[model samples]
Target chain A: MTAAKTNDPPPPPIKYDFLGALLSYLVPGLGQMTQGRFGKGILFFVSLYGLFFYGWLLGSKKNVYLPDYHSGETSIVSRLASDLYTRFQFVGQFPIGMAAWPAIYQYVVSVQGNEKPPLNGFMSSPSLEELNNLQRNGDKTWDLGWVYTVIAGVLNVLVIYDALAGAAFREVRATPGPLTPPNGGPSK
Target chain B: MTIYVHLPVLIVVVSLVYSATRYDSWNKILREALHWGVRMTSFLFMIGLVLYALSTFL
Candidate 1:
């Protein structure tokens, strides 16, 4: 009698966790933690948050900000240029989720100027002269701090992708050996 | 001075997060992170040195 062939089990269905993605967007690494990836989640949390706070500490919490758009500049070109240089950094900072909320809130307050006791304390826009003075006097900490914070946020974008899609690539198990001739000829 | 002081720490944080996303194995992640961090720091140092040399000459 011929033996019956055993069918292989089907692969598990891929489930897209939208809520988890949202959680991660709201708070870095939350999605991974929700998906039981505690180690990865914790790593992202500590690293991203640490970098964010380090930047804040270095810059006195004033590095992340939007330009004062409503400062009554009527020239479109100047306004656009100012926004590009001053506010465009928000693009990088936005991905860090809650870590960036305070900055966003401060930006809104600065733009509206209606809020009593603005959300940002001691956060005044430094004039060009003052900035030059700071740089000349060897106070380049603010520039470096701003860059670090922006980079941290950019890194979170990758972390968020990993959390949502899982690891980008799988670990290769087999050791790669040197190629051999088809007929097992003498090795080169 | 402050910028240079934080450069190594920033490199480590960046490498750790970057490698963690690329690999699932903790051992592989840590190993790759150190490798990447060293590589990146070396690259930056080389660039800085080149720039300084060019500035002096030009």
Candidate 2:
């Protein structure tokens, strides 16, 4: 009257891959290559960076930026809110990781309130007046250019997840050994 | 215009990036991307048609 016990292999252990995620965040598709997924890594890196740089080119290299200009708000919260409000586009651009760092660097230097900082203009923050001028003078293509950068950055968020989680549909196959289960062989 | 020229490229990139997240194999990812790219392009074209008709009528 007793039912027979069945043996089922345990699910594969899920590793918390901090470094992989970090690497992929810094450079798109890097984590996958580190994890031996070379093709995906290459695809990710080339595609993401291509899109990002193309957008940079479209915008004439002035798309990704955090403005040094901020209205004098009393609290840290207000200042933070003001920055976000002004640079809301940065939320999209920021996820591309270090590629977007120049903007932040520009802001830090700008805190000194320099009339003209001695730094390369790469992703540098423009003054509020300058930003307005750029917008007024430039056309719709400029808007689309930043949109490309934003899309590239946002897509990278997914890449980071994939780097940490490994492939979503990957089967956890035990190595071939005396005790290992024999159902499927190596992937094609 | 640059915007119109870039639409297909955007679709292809978006499809490839999204497909990469779903599967490990490059072959499967690329295949899925092709399918999704077509679907997305068609969807967008339909929406454009609808908007165009609305603008003309209204």
Candidate 3:
């Protein structure tokens, strides 16, 4: 009679890094690819890139270019200023300026050495100019950037949730220990 | 500028810089950076909404 043969137990589950998934949310697609989900990663990047492009276009049309410098007038160089300046006269200005210049001038200009954003909406002569800009392109037509920002914000939330879910999936499979009975029961 | 505007912009700048840095290893810092980015973006977006409301009414 031959002796009974023994076999090695199955390997434990693979664990995933939660931090990796969070990072993927920041970069969109990096985390998923790192976790070996190439298809998911590609999809993430596509969605992220698509919204980014749309946001950029909407922002550009609104004259809200992301400033290159944050310090001062010289500090705020813009990349699009070179290319789109002619097409959109205000291409390099921050998007907020569309709403800001008018309101600020109305409230703060009357006060001496005023530098603060207005606490309430104020109107002044220069506001007429800004309003004309708003109206020239049709009142409703130029307000689309707000819509873009809202949509992009929503998409980012979805991407973050997806990343978190992927991380949770990783956690479920991490350990490889045998399923020994908790009360020290005999192995099957 | 008002604190609301300044704070949101500062948050965004710090988050963006942190996210774009060169780091050799993955660490808790990266996770925190992402969290900060999400927070800052949310803050700015909220402020944007407030501005929208103010623009439309007051």
Candidate 4:
């Protein structure tokens, strides 16, 4: 008796979890953890947070900030120039959610001239004299700190992408060929 | 201390995070991370030596 030939079913399509991706954006490894990838999630959380805090400590919280264009300088050209030149590093730092808040708050307070913003370790604005001193001293530490913080922020973006996109390369299953019989018979 | 000391720490962290993202298995991740870390450190050392030589001669 001849064996009946049957076609194999197609593999299921890959499903992307948008909510998980969003959660990853909000908190670096939360999405992976939610998806039961506890080890990966924790690893991401620890590494990213460690780098961020270390950078912050190195920079003394001055590294992350939105550009401060002077008051009433609403010209689009000037804004673009400020962003491109003075605050470009912020483009990298903005990906870090909560850790970046102090800088954002400082920017808002500086622009709005809010009632003397309270002095805190993270948000304490350096006085003009201190700024001048930093400038005159040509402090390489400040530059290094800024670079470290920017790098940390940029690296978190990689973590977020990993959480959302799984491995860059995945192993795909080989499809069954017509020449190969399901019961292991050789092709005629 | 010179800022260059931070380079090794940065490389280690980057290698660990990068390897962790690529593999699900802890052992595989750690092995690959160490491999990458060594490779990066060696490459950086070579570049630093070349730069120092250039600076000294020029």
Candidate 5:
């Protein structure tokens, strides 16, 4: 009697790693490196961080910041909503991890009315007049700079996802049958 | 020219980063990056042409 072939059971869902995702979010490509994908991690590091920092440099260290709201309104939530609308570029930049946090710190300090003299303008928002002056100058480079930063952050999000979800396509598959050599030699 | 000075770097970075996410091997990554970079550059060029036309006429 012919024996039946037994099918293998499905593998468990250990592919999605939340810790790896968190590590990747903190440092672009780091989780993949830790997961033994050294080349991929390094590539992500160079690509995302390089783009973000280059954009920051092009902006003369003035981009990646959210301006504080002092609208004198009693509703904190409404004020936050309004400021978020105006400073939406930061939403794109925030995924870049610690490199973008100084802006948040500055915004929070200024919003809470504890903006100190020691704050040496590291990611701090410029005054309305100063911002208007810069805008009036029609410097297209500044606009492009922040755009690069946003793109870097957005792209890093994909890196984080890769760390969590693993590769998009399976790298291995079953070969149906052995073939002859390219030169038409017999199969071994 | 000043505005577009950063384009080449941006193009390379974006294409590489994007392609890296979809594949594991360096061979595939570099090849896909080239395809993505070319397509994006062409698309951007088309947009620039439109803008240039608008500027010239209006």
Candidate 6:
């Protein structure tokens, strides 16, 4: 009597949803929480809140300018006091201020000069004619703040997901599971 | 930098306490700890979603 030998295919690879994870990562706390990481997720969200408050405080002091095409000017809204600015700046990296990504992108692109012409209240530099033209045609500058905010929001979601998923995957891998024989064969 | 820096330390502290109380052996500890971690992480995930919505609307 001879025993038969059979080869079995390898188990299917564990599917890792990288994009889903990335979405979580863009946010402070998300993905892992979705998978059941409650503590970490809460911590991340709280951290985000702290950063936002800090930025809000800082943004309160100096003008956080958002160009308004309709008005044909840079609408420089007064921000918080200098004290608030200093306090917020100290923790700037965490909450990621309103201008966080915008500042970083601007720096990366090496935009030397200010987009809004340095002048008094919004569109002070532009003549009446130019202002009228911008208003009629549409102002890209005004939209920049909102656009950036949306981008940041989207990125935050991604980050949160990524963080949670990454941790979950790591935890899963680190924890061992029961072993089984290859080829669906029973171990004797 | 403010809260972010403190977070790692906080996570570690919580993990230690959780492992100490919730775990019996290495495997048990690891499993429980991970489960808790994931749970905590998920909570944050929901909060983040809420915040994102808040940011968008308000």
| Candidate maximizing lDDT | 5
What does candidate 6's lDDT look like per residue over B1-58, in tens digits? 2333323433443443344233224466467767767776678779979999999999
Instruction: Give the clashing residue pairs of candidate 3, or none.
Output: A12-A176, A13-A173, A14-A173, A14-A174, A15-A174, A64-A95, A69-A75
The TM-scores, one per candidate, come to 0.75, 0.84, 0.34, 0.78, 0.83, 0.29
* Every model's DockQ: 0.80, 0.76, 0.03, 0.55, 0.84, 0.03
> Would you list the rank order by lDDT, best first?
5, 2, 1, 4, 3, 6
What's the interface RMS deviation of candidate 3? 11.7
Q: What share of the true interface contacts does candidate 6 keep?
A: 0.00
Off by more than 4 A, model 2: A1-10, A75-78, A128-130, A173-188
Maximum-DockQ candidate: 5
- The Cα local distance difference test for each model comes to 0.77, 0.84, 0.45, 0.72, 0.85, 0.42
Candidate 4, residues A42-125: lDDT per residue as tens digits? 887787777766776666566666655545567856754675366687777767667777776776666666656644635545
Off by over 4 Å in 3: A1-16, A61-132, A167-188, B1-58
**Model 1 C-alpha lDDT per residue in residues A64-146, reported as the tens digit of each score:** 66556546767756755676566677788778888777655655566666544264344444446765665576577877877
| Pairs clashing within candidate 4 | none
Which residue runs of candidate 5 sit more than 4 Å off their true CA positions?
A1-14, A117-119, A173-188, B53-58
- In candidate 6 the C-alpha lDDT for residue A173 amounts to 27
- Residue-level lDDT of model 3, residues A43-120, one tens digit each, is 556555454444435433333222221222332234334323433422212221222244325333433334443434
Give stretches of model 1 more than 4 Å off: A1-14, A71-85, A120-138, A171-188, B55-58
Q: Score candidate 1 by TM-score against the native.
A: 0.75
In CAPRI terms, model 3 is classed as incorrect
Give the residue spans of candidate 4 off by over 4 A: A1-12, A75-84, A119-121, A124-129, A135-139, A171-188
Interface root mean square deviation for model 4, in Å?
A: 1.8
RMSD of each: 8.8, 5.4, 17.0, 6.1, 5.9, 17.5
* Tens-digit per-residue lDDT, A68-152, candidate 5: 6646767877777777788899889989888898888887788878757226988888777877766677677777889999999
Instruction: Give the CA lDDT, 0 to 100, for residue A105 in model 2.
Output: 79
Better of 1 and 5 by lDDT: 5
